[model samples]
Target: MSQIQGWAAQQAGQPLVRSSFDLGPLGAEEVEVAVDYCGICHSDLSMIANEWGMSRFPFVPGHEVIGRVLALGEQAKGLRVGQRVGIGWTAGSCMHCRQCLSGHQNLCAELEATIGGHHGGFADKVRAHWAWTIPLPDGIDLPSAGPLLCGGITVLKPFLAYNIGPTARVGVVGIGGLGHMAVKFAKAWGCEVTAFTSTAAKADEARSFGAHHVVSSRDANAIQAIAGSLDLLLVTVNVSLDWGALLGTLAPRGRMHVVGAVLEPIPVPAFALIVTEREVSGSPTGSPVDIATLLDFATRHDVRPQVEMFPMDQVNAALKHLADGKARYRIVLEGAKG
Candidate 1:
């Protein structure tokens, strides 16, 4: 076993503390990564707070990871020592499942998430299964690539899956970590991007992310202004919303793709969809292939997150910043030596 330093919650509702943990012997299909940076995602906060009720004690919670490959097992291939790499929410998936067999590993029932089912990148080093680790682009730095592992891919994959292109008039609801990325991706794709936020103060920030137009979602007049104008709506907020408000903004045969929180249970008016044949769906994280592609696209287009870096020891302050929406766009924890 290899000994390393990490910050983990000793118990539920407790703050993360520095501790020494063991990394078991590397498996034949595994590679050791020296974690350089890790994003402080909402999921990490949720898990540490035990919001989902499945968090393990002393949990090391961080899925958006970017690091250098320090070592490789005998069977690990296509990756070299000292190469920059990244790992997202998923670590393993049952190869026999239909989704996994079909190449949609994120949909596999037996998939293991980085922070939940396995030890994640909050530690100094993480042993990732080779098949799940992705190579990072040369143009992106480790800190910039950290959030791309999860937040970037989450927004980018749905656009690729739904075939959204130049002609699509896209609406991104919310302007936080996920919504901000949605704006950059949608604009880079040549879509007419409109950002919807309840708070008027976020309008300028939303526009800075590439949204051509920003509207106060709470204002009925503003909401009515865009009725039947959008071809696609990407709801990026976890809070409950009136589905009719969004469905009304869509043009005929429009689609709404959700990839936000797990606890959201919005009441959708069926008539909103039945009348115009609009569709509503959800997306999880992307497949390894999708992530690799997204990394290239992000670098090619300069689509990067505005992140605030914090030391791992300042995790509690970082969490508070994220919760208060004080961070510019994304929050990352550095100082973890993969």
Candidate 2:
């Protein structure tokens, strides 16, 4: 490929402009995909603004990618040209590392994020190691399915990791992008699901997403009403909240698992753990097998994200919509038109 056309920001907080760059020769283990659609995640905005201080100039940002395989290297196996596939937060990892060997490749020391140092799915085409270029299952909705690659896996990782069961009582704090998916996954898993949000307007919508209950995340009384009743509390909001009150809602031995990237340190009392054996933990997106499992589960359950769509060329407008918090649940960018 001579030049891969893409939308990129030349500097921090600038609107993405038409840009193209060469990846040169594709590696022996790589696969190139013709991007059809990509989801706009909040983290994408962070990367675009260099908020994490890791943004490289001419940065391309779109990790929740859905497209068809266009090219494959000689060593790329188990995938065919024209096969529909998806790529998430990770594009590649050191295949020889212990984490990769043990099927925990997301934790590999040198994980290559799609938009980190490399180009991402905001392009007409994107490339990843064959392993990270996941095949889309049959009968799945291709447009809205992009978020499943990134945010879906993010919320589902806790259920898979903690071995959450049907009998467990779960709480999802936040009802936007990630939390909504969490509610659906929890309800589909047959767990009793409670969704917490500060906004009263989202309550009914949360329940529509399969939440069994809705409560005020800002109300201390609301948090206390369910005190010690939850088996798992999944925090999906990046903003800080009543940490103690939220933690107090967990049952003995229950876990407070965080998927959101909260910037400040959360203060947890020592006795909070010692007395009830409560735990706090966090995880990024999942591994390849984990992603495949998420896709399969979503397919069987008819779980799909509610999304607003924009033509890929209107990326700046879409970005502003998301930045202004007008995106109802999530947003997807379609491939550029002919």
Candidate 3:
């Protein structure tokens, strides 16, 4: 029957349960990954609840995946059997598109998300296009490397896309899954990092993640205290905040780059941007080459996501922990190892 086993949600807002799918032969460019460790991202919660209105029934929700190559399609390129690899949010793209031809496959109009139309890594095996299946480097920490596939790339893309310089001052809002990694990447990229959190208790932990300064994202005065300072402010929380105060922290010509999936519409005061010539921008996770670059940079700088571990069979518990906002940073599901 070609049955593949995984955890799946029968409907929105339901807990996942054991399920199987009769997936046929792999595609020409496909590579199958045997799940070893998969990170639980906030987006997984959203999809499971249909927050983005794109959830599919009987869905397997996972994207920040670390695994080993189990099989390859006839035309899959650049990888061999039994190789260790990772897959992020994207699983495939139409290679003939302009975005793909230009090395921006992540921006492809027909992008296929790992957990969107496709079953993802919360399972015995998952499949993705050869390009999106990234190669992990030597000396990389396998256990903690899963979140880097998604959250790591989400925060790292801004620096490369916008050319954020080493001397630039960077501020990261919300010191959780995405923000912590942003702090580390900013520090390793030679930028001075400022970490902001609504929870004062996380201030010290944020500092430990490489922030030079820590502030309360909810404190208007604290936001003003660092006013006109940062060259780039990376917002990583999905929740709404004091947007105006945070916007004011940027230096003249500074940029506010958001990687979080904040659901509310952000009202930007035009004057706030006009006077200082500041800018606002956002990006999805990076392309194949960009992910490879992130992996290489992380290896050389010894940067990795801080993660809490859970057994794959205990995935429902892990998802609940993330939903209740109790995860210290990130959660990763451990599967059977080779």
Candidate 4:
């Protein structure tokens, strides 16, 4: 093994600094990718700040990665050298687990997160199990495709799990990174899309992103105006909101699903769900099969994330920009140029 260059935080809540470290050896089922572009996700901030208390120090935080295969282990399958591919939140999983055997590797009990205890794509090179390294389809733009690996799949999985159809009316809560993509997917899937946001400025932008309607998520009246109108409501914001009001917008038997990482308890009136038989649920990133399906759908619909670019060396600046809420949607880091 040789030293690989990357930016990392020495301690929790510390700014990222340029550093070099060894990658040890590639596992039998792993493949190495030469980093090209990596998306800056809010989850990266959580790990950098150790918000979840599961972060390891010297953290190299990036999971949404796009790169070309530089090498592959002897036992790695379905990938070749120089293949352009993407890796998401899960780097590896116990292949024999019930979930993995059923193609739900994301839910495996021993899932290995890219930055959980391992270095991630904020480096010159990164590695993942061959099963999780998905080959990019022909039509996806390389620069903007990174976020689809994580944020895109997070939203897409619910649609597949719930079997939402073309006639369903869908609502997306939030208009930033994840919510914006949800709008595009829902629209492309033939659903009438409504975007919920607190910012008046985003209302029009949400429509431009394929939302059929825009409502102020903070306005109780606006939320109530859409009562019993939606078949599915996707919550993508990390902050707490008026759950009661949001629930009211769903039709009887409609489902409210959470893909966001909201920290506090969401209080729901029992009668709100009990009377209508409405349901609430949450999911993590999707399995490899789901990622493949998402890529195919994105290519077919020409869906791409709105992104700002930063060079890998300027990762700290990029992180600050995302933290300041300055990014229009998603931020991506270009790898060190050869």
TM-score of each model, in listed order: 0.96, 0.99, 0.98, 0.98
Worst 10 residues of 3 by lDDT: 1-10
For TM-score, candidate 2 versus 3, the one ahead is: 2
**Which clashing pairs does model 1 show?**
34-338, 35-338
- The residue-by-residue lDDT of candidate 2 on 231-326, one tens digit each, is 999999999999999999999999999999999999999999999999999999999999999999999998998899999999999999999988
Q: Each candidate's lDDT (Cα)?
A: 0.85, 0.94, 0.93, 0.93
- Candidate 2 Cα RMSD after full superposition onto the native fold (Å): 1.0
Candidate numbers sorted by lDDT from highest down: 2, 4, 3, 1
Each prediction's number of clashing residue pairs: 2, 0, 0, 0
User: Per-residue lDDT of 1-338 in model 1, one digit per residue for the tens?
Assistant: 47767788888778888788877778788888888899988888889889899888878888888888888989888999999899999887776788988889888888888887567778888777787889988887667678888999999987888888897899999898989999999999899999999988889988889999998878778888889999999988988776777789999999888888847577778888898898889888888889999999998888998899998778888888987878778999896442
Best of the candidates, lDDT: 2
Which candidate, 3 or 4, has the higher lDDT?
A: 4
Alpha-carbon lDDT of model 1: 0.85
Which 10 consecutive residues of model 2 have the lowest summed lDDT?
329-338
Cα-based RMSD of the predictions, in order?
1.5, 1.0, 1.1, 1.0
Q: Candidate 4: deviation at residue 318, Å?
A: 0.5
TM-score of 2: 0.99
Question: lDDT, candidate 1, residue 96?
Answer: 76
